[model samples]
Target: MRTTHALVQLALALMSAPQERHWGYELSKTSGVRSGAMYPRLRQMLDEGWLVDGWETSEEAGGRPARRYYRLTEDGQRELGALLRRAESDSRFGGLDLRMA
Candidate 1:
């Protein structure tokens, strides 16, 4: 992984709920990364086999398209955790609460 700032933010966000499913938009909103940046990183994670994605349907969405959900694999937890640890050491990402809740 390249470990960009957006990737660090995404690691923090995903770590916050490792067991839960996430949508691209939700990740974008929480990580403060735009869709243009978010989706490509997500694709990278998927290609790296650190994450898996699937579709979801809910009455809550009503007429909207089925939502796509992503979840971290066991390897993802380790990868993201390592990413956060590196960020913790990097001065650029200092003082960021990069721990999982």
Candidate 2:
């Protein structure tokens, strides 16, 4: 995937909770990326097989509308880690700090 600031932020947010599931709104808040920019990036990640998504059942959501959740796949974890490291090294990224778990 092409590296962009918003994408890097999103990757960091996901890396912060690698094993936990993430949904759109929470990702937006955590990444500090607006929905307009975030969702399209998410779709690109999904298309690239960097993420797997599933819907939370209404019961699981406490009877609210079913919400979609995303998690990184094994390949995605490795790839994102590499991406973060690369971003950290790139002067364009402005000294990004990367320490992914």
Q: What is the lDDT of residue 49 in candidate 2?
A: 86
Considering summed lDDT, which 10 consecutive residues are worst modelled in model 2?
92-101
Q: Candidate 1's residue-wise lDDT over 1-101, tens digit each? A: 68788888888889899999998889999999898888889999999988999988677568888899999999998999888887887998875777678
Reference-based lDDT, residue 13, model 2: 91
Please give the lDDT score for candidate 2.
Answer: 0.88
User: What is the lDDT, from 0 to 100, of the residue 8 in candidate 2?
Assistant: 92
Q: Report the poorest 10 consecutive residues by lDDT, candidate 1.
A: 92-101
- Candidate 1 segments exceeding 4 Å error: 58-61
Give the Cα error of residue 91 in candidate 1, in Å.
Answer: 0.6
